[model samples]
Target: MATDRRDRTPTADPPATDDEHAAHLERSRRVWDRWSDWYGTSESDFEPIREAAIDRLDLQRGDRVLEIGCGPGVNFERVRRDIGAEGELVAVDYSPGMLENARARIEAHGWENVRVLRADATTVEFDDPFDVALATLSLSVMPDIRRAAETVYRSLVPGGRIAVVDIRSFPSGPARVLNPLVRRFLRWYANWNPDGGVVDALATVFDECEVVDTHMAGTSYTVVCEKRDAG
Candidate 1:
């Protein structure tokens, strides 16, 4: 088994005072801006999860897709492929550095049907509704999970699908009972992203939802949601 440092290291950041948390978000933006230079090197870890999202979406030709917080544009091509050669894709992320990576990927691939934007995920607005929307691991760091989920809901067309994959304090079934403990231990680790829990926060916004155990040593999960008629 390949033991990845990002996976094995804790996910919860140290306890942050409101000021510390604000400063951290600012630092996070700068760090990822620098990471744009090394974006491609991070693709290996992204492939599987990207594939999972594509497979689960099961899109058709000409489908319109929206990706929130699309770091380094890792999944743009895959989503385009899923929608077929004629489909359209719109990807947004808050970091200019990350958007730079995303733009490079799109340009490198010569994908003419894609649009990239440097904007916060919570406030992204699409020109038109999409057939499907994805937040692939991006919402895990969101400061406002419910608001973000609502924005996703409003961005989609009727009966459109939305999927979010994120990391949790624990991995699976009965073992998940230890999340509180795991969360406590991880709080002391560096790089711990302690944004309030997304899974629970999003439950109030979607009508149909399902969660599945994913990769990274079963430490992460994917949540698939369907927009309601009224939502």
Candidate 2:
């Protein structure tokens, strides 16, 4: 299996300071911008898993779909296609390069129903709730994982569905014995990851949640949450 390079980077001191957050976003944009053209192409190596994540949306025509941290709009097109002419698809991400790449693809695909925007997942507003929402592999990088999950929970309709998948942090038996040293190193290189607290946090918002799938190595997991109907 391919290891996520992002996980190996030490979380910066103080986790994510204001200045550090700004620099993090800037660095992300620069890094993505450099890979814009090949952003969603097969050479990217994430295309297959990306498609799988989109498939979890189970979109229907006329449905309202929102994608948070939509990198290069890889899965946006898939959702748009599923929505057909009557539905709406909105994609958001903080990285300018990601938005640019996503916009280009939306145009190339002639998907007028799809809209891409540059916005922070931690705090973004939508005109109305959506029928389905997806935050594939993106929420894991958020600086405020809890607030972001709340935002996502709030963005859904009364009985909407949310699919989230990402790499979470866990301690290895040997690594645990190593003490704070390992955690100290991780705290410096990584940002607020969704894969860690989402399972528990989501339980508070959604009526019921289930871990739908997981990588054999336990490095990543996918979960589905449903918003139950009102009383």
Candidate 3:
């Protein structure tokens, strides 16, 4: 097995200040904007696994759900179906190109309940507390996972749930050899940090957190967390 990079290397941390983070966000937005067409929102083979991640939320009718980094709104319909007409869906993404696609999807479906907002996940001011949230393959790309996690936790109602499906470093077995390639590909493709603390940050902020499971050939892990009831 390969040695743990955590033990031998100290990679630079993400932007710590709001300005730096904003710049980082702009860079990501530009990247996505330029490539949004190539990275279309069409369905894929991983749809089932992604749906499984949403399933972890156990959405109910009339629930208010938030989707962070909701690229192109591919999951919008799936979520709206669960939430029904009474429920509201707020999907946020920084990329204007992506938001355009999302808005198109919403209009095409005539999903009056689904709303798209163009804002950064870490700083977006949510007008209301959400009942459930889902972040699919999006948290790892965030400039600051801890800040993003804090924002998500703060936006949820007491006892509200969140399901995050993200990539994690393949730590064991023969797959360890593929870590370097995987890391490079993900970084180039989306600036994703597979070694990031998305789960750890959420676990620290949420009262109850669990790794629901790993999917996509063990390349992704789904974490479910619940905000504690108000004291």
Candidate 4:
């Protein structure tokens, strides 16, 4: 069996200082911009998992949805289908190149209900609340997972749902042996940390959380959460 290149790795660097964090964000944006084209074509293997995450959102017709780190708008069609013509989909990403690709997709498909915005997921705010929010294979790449999760939590209306899918470190087992090669591949291609504490971050903000393990020997996990009533 072939192994995915997103398994266990070394620990991520400690939390960044304000200035250092800003620089890291900028670098990440630039890297995605450079990789936008290839990323869109090379990630076919992740499509099933991505679609599974979207399905867990349980979106309804006319629902307002927000997608963070929506690279190249890969999930646009599926989301549009779920939400229908009356619904709205907002796809946000920090990389201009990636957003450009997403825009092209929207134009080609004539999906007027879909909008793409260029912004950092951690800092962006929405004036209107969303019914559902999704972050697929993205939370691990965020500069500050907790802050990003908080932003998403606040952007959703009470009772809204949020779903996140991301890579995680493999537990001790035969799979552990593949860690070094997988880590090297991820570091070289995307600068992503498999063990980025994404689940813990979401748990801090959501009223309830359900975790599901997927892919090779649980190399990745998805978390689905529901917003609690504001007291």
Candidate 5:
């Protein structure tokens, strides 16, 4: 079962007011801005986990996809390859520094189909519905995971697919011993709270949700779901 393990050291309770949420958002943006340059380099080891998430996306040559919190565009190459020249990839990040890296990556590769925008995933608007939506290691950091998931769900067309890969609290037993160290590492590096209720949030928005434990003794999970037709 999933547990709520949000970091209590930083704030004992979740934000209760708009001002508090705004403050947390600003702090998170600043953290990512400072870490943008080293973000990709630091996460090199987790490339496979990201690849696994993208694989489940099952992108096709002409599919339009939306990627939330696409820091440094780490998934760009694989997404580009799968989506091909005909498809469109819309990537959003709240951090300008992160978007800068993503833009640079796109320019360097001459990928015309990929567009990077600086916007908060919870409130960003899409002109067209997407065929697929993906969020890798990002949902846990959102100011409101449920809002973000709902936004993603609304941005997708009926029958559209969504995938989310994120970290959660470690399971009990020997793995429980490593929680403190792992939590500290995540807090210092990504400002993530593993108790964000990501899976629960997704379940509320998507018609069907499937979760797979991806790594670190059930500390990470991959969720795939499909939007059902309104009819």
Candidate 6:
């Protein structure tokens, strides 16, 4: 675990109006709907990173888990395997097409303990807290990464954990040479900067944020973190 010592306060964009935010969400949903079926086709290489991030979540039997942006339920099998039948899974995403695909996957597997909800992860509220949370390839595409991260922080119980796997556009040392190409490609491919201070935002929201792994010339990474316990 490589500790992040950068400034905890990542720069924030000005708040968007309600209509602007809604339009943003709608646009993102449409893009995801278009990409949902094909997302895994091009992303097969990331399987190991995703697996490692899931492992860092430190899942346990009967633990309740929250998966933000649970795109097409790609993670359900492994996560369910970790938590078992006694556990509960609540996965949320804003795209109906993606959720439909997820539902189909759920039905195919006949997973009884999993629930899928279509909602904006940034604003969705829950009455029950989660033991562990996951956000893989999701936060960087969000309109407000900090707000979404804070929401995840609030959704967790004291001492809960979260694992995130996504692009790391900014890297120091010799890897920094790829920064320009990385950011450009992300914007062109995803219409957003996916790794924009995401680890920093998580650091601000959680007690600890560690870069557990980096891949692809240091262009992407996995982050694992733990929320501080409230005694």
**lDDT (C-alpha, whole model) for all candidates:** 0.71, 0.69, 0.80, 0.81, 0.82, 0.83
Cα lDDT, model 4, residue 153: 84
* Segments of candidate 5 deviating more than 4 angstroms: 1-16, 178-181
Runs off by more than 4 Å, candidate 6: 1-11, 170-181
- List pairs with backbone clashes in candidate 3: none
Any idea how many clashes model 4 has? Answer: 0
As for lDDT, the candidate ahead, 4 or 5, is 5
TM-score result, candidate 4: 0.88
**Which residue pairs clash within candidate 5?**
5-195
Question: lDDT, candidate 2, residue 159?
Answer: 76
Ranking by lDDT: 6, 5, 4, 3, 1, 2
Off by over 4 Å in 1: 1-25, 171-195
Q: Residue 153 of candidate 5: its Cα lDDT? A: 85
Going through the candidates in the order shown, the clash numbers are 2, 9, 0, 0, 1, 1
| True-vs-predicted CA distance for residue 227, candidate 4, Å | 1.0
User: Lowest-scoring 10 consecutive residues by lDDT in candidate 2?
Assistant: 1-10
Clashing pairs in 6: 140-194
TM-score (all chains, Cα) for each model: 0.78, 0.75, 0.88, 0.88, 0.88, 0.89
Instruction: Estimate candidate 6's RMSD in Å.
Output: 2.7
Assess candidate 6 and give its lDDT. 0.83
Residue 215, candidate 4: Cα error in Å is 1.4
Residues 1-231, model 1: lDDT tens digits: 112222232343234466765665565577667667776786777667767866777788999998887878878877877776688998878778888778878889889999888765666677788899888767766555666777888888878887777766755677788877777654432233555667655665665666754666677777777775754
Top-scoring candidate (lDDT): 6
